[model samples]
Target: MKPDYELLVRGNNLRLKDDFLGMSNVTLIQGPSGPILFDTGGYISRLGLLKALDARGLKPADIPLVFLSHLHFDHAHNVDLFAHAEFLVSRREWDYVGAPHPDDLLVPWGIREQLSKSRVTLIEGEGQIDRGIGFFPAPGHTPGCFAIELDTERGTTVIAGDAIKYAKEAILRRCDMAFDEIEVGTATIRNILDRADRIMPGHFPELVRLPDGNFVWDEAAPFELMVR
Candidate 1:
């Protein structure tokens, strides 16, 4: 049977001068084995993340697995919430974070120490995370970034984290914040676009690829923000 997915917290790409409001997507996947929490949102979305799980009749402790796309602060900061789940992060990422490039401010200073306290399974190369869910290296945005490929009733779906940050990156085949060579990042984007029937981008609404090789938002309206 195919797996089912839901975007627990929609990612937002907002900027204010030199600051970026990093609200990365948090997703829940009901795979054949059990429910998997993909990419725990950061401190900014902590409360909402808890509420989202509660709405689905789940608590952080109820999650059995947590798949981190990478260790960027916006995406991995909330791992502590799921104290009982086994985290799956890339081995390359684990090693790279030890001495990440000085300019890669996204890698929180003490994240490695935090992760060491948890039960983490360092993934290597392409492999299956669970029934119907396969993962492969999708480097460039980060040296060890990985993306999920799942078989759904519709077809093949890719949960492309920062490897394909948004629709623009997929469409234009470029990255705005690449840690690797720009060509490598663009190449990764091209591969994902070619392979996925639908893409869950890191900071954009889900996209459905058309037969004519174009993509459109998947029935959901763009994210909205409200200020009082």
Candidate 2:
């Protein structure tokens, strides 16, 4: 089965807000087994996100699995929207949420009940959630920050989450730019770059590798994810 997918680039050009510091992206993966919703976009874009999904002939109820990159409000606000989908979160991530630090202000509190009230799987480290979907710890933006990987038609593509917020930052190997852990962030970026053919970052433009082992931003690329 090929990993077929589309990105609702809400964090990028979807909204026009000069003051918005960063953008959030939500992905819809039409897996062989079922539909997978990756990240729920932002709270402010709830209605827009729903419309976007409707435009694609999909609904939150139709999604069977909801995988979150992290629990940041911008990327996780709409999680509760998928009333029946099973939510997958990092075990370590919830630990921080259970006891948030001052710096970890992005902790999602509104959907606290939804997070655990439904069927939730606490992913610890790297493991396969489905046939072609996998995840591993890549903390930086948050304590239990993680990223999701997919076996797509393009190759091994990874949704790098906030681990490498921007493709430019990945090229620089800069971890100091993250919100939480710094050193681990840089290492995680390197780790993803070394393996993934393409990376859909959390904030910046998606990055595809060139023949020269360099990455360039692709603003027009449509991620047709297919999982085999």
Candidate 3:
């Protein structure tokens, strides 16, 4: 049976509601070949994605491949759920995840060990994963943060994980607390806005379009002016 692609918007994390303007978004893309999951939510809500997939008559095993935007716990904590799937991530991001870091313990040792055993594919630059799907490196949010581009009948949709958190942040070049560097994140967001017509940010809504012929970020009508 041909698989159906869908983006499942899970629960919103309001822990930092007072400080950061960010939420967790989990994407479910069911292609003709198989299903692909993007950025699993935190460990606590890991099964939440599985439940969502179950509702669609799919399971973690049905997902042949999984792409992670980065190694941050919030974005990749539930990766272990798909042990049978080949996990893809940016080469730089993989190294960062494997690297020993005593300062930050957000990523647990068990998760890293599990990842080491899984089928991990490290990608460099832009490359076509399938007929209409492609992966591109969009560092800045993290050293190896990347985005997934899908060509559809509607238009080209870029699933920009953390490279561009919110539509408003992308338009205004606004960096959140999770970004490693502001300048790099800003440049990456600019690169995405320059290429993609519609952007599916990791957080805040599904897709936002770049106003006709506008390459620069617009602060006035940031998130409110999205294409939906």
Candidate 4:
């Protein structure tokens, strides 16, 4: 069966007035087996996700799997909330997240502890997670960052977690401020644009499609202003 998915915009672009530097969107994918979530948003976002699920008549326990695009605080800070779900992440990303870093304290250690007990699935290559949902390594934004390609009834939707934060950024080849490696990030952005028919960025408003075989912004505006 084809998976049903919904992109939940968890955080805002302007995180704190002057910081136009975060892309924190959580994707909820309901498959034949069970529900799966992509990215957990920031620490404060856990309650918001629970409340949103509650309003929709769903519960956190309903989610059996959770995938992280990367280990950045803005993307996976609330991972500890899904205690019952199996966590999926790229092997490279897992190594990066698990590596000894002085800044690790910034993220809740509880989350890491929970992860240790939870069933963690480390993806190593491009493959299908389900009939129509697939994952492929798109390193650069982070060593282990991966992108998802979902073949939906509407079209093929690519959930680009920070590989291409904004549609315009993908078009112009602009890298995010927090990228660990700029060259790798740019290459990943290009790879995404090459394969995606519809692009749903991490913190952007909604999906944008290349309807006429050309990059189109969500508001039908020019790429520059749309990203700005």
Ranking the candidates on lDDT from highest down gives: 1, 2, 4, 3
Tens-digit per-residue lDDT, 54-172, candidate 2: 89887778888988887878888877787677888898877777776686667677556767767888889789877888889888767778888899998989887778776666788
- lDDT string, candidate 4, 1-228, tens digits: 676677554444654574434547788877667777888888656677888778878787878888888777788877667778888888887777666345334334445566777788889989877778899887766678888888877677788887777656765876664435778788877777777777767766555555565666554311222354
Model 3 Cα lDDT, one tens digit per residue, 1-228: 333356564434244544533346788865656678888877655666778888988878888898888887778877778888899888888777676344445555566577767898888999977777888888776778899887766477788887877666665766553435677778788888777767667665554464564433223322322376
| TM-score of every prediction relative to native | 0.96, 0.88, 0.81, 0.83
lDDT assessment of candidate 4:
0.72
All-Cα superposition RMSD per candidate: 1.4, 5.9, 5.9, 5.0
Best-matching candidate per TM-score: 1
Ten contiguous residues minimizing lDDT sum, candidate 3: 216-225
Listed per model in order, the count of residue pairs whose N, CA or C atoms clash below 3 Å is 0, 12, 0, 0
- What tens digits encode model 1's per-residue C-alpha lDDT throughout 1-228? 789899999887776799887588899999999999889988988998999999999999889999999999999998889867899999998888888877788897788778778899999999998889999989889888999999999789999988988878877778777876677888889899899999998888898989998878855535566999
Residue 95 displacement (Å), model 4: 1.0
**Model 4 off-target regions past 4 Å?**
15-23, 100-111, 217-228
lDDT of 2 at 226: 57
The deviation in Å at residue 71 for candidate 4 is 1.1
lDDT: the better of candidates 1 and 3: 1
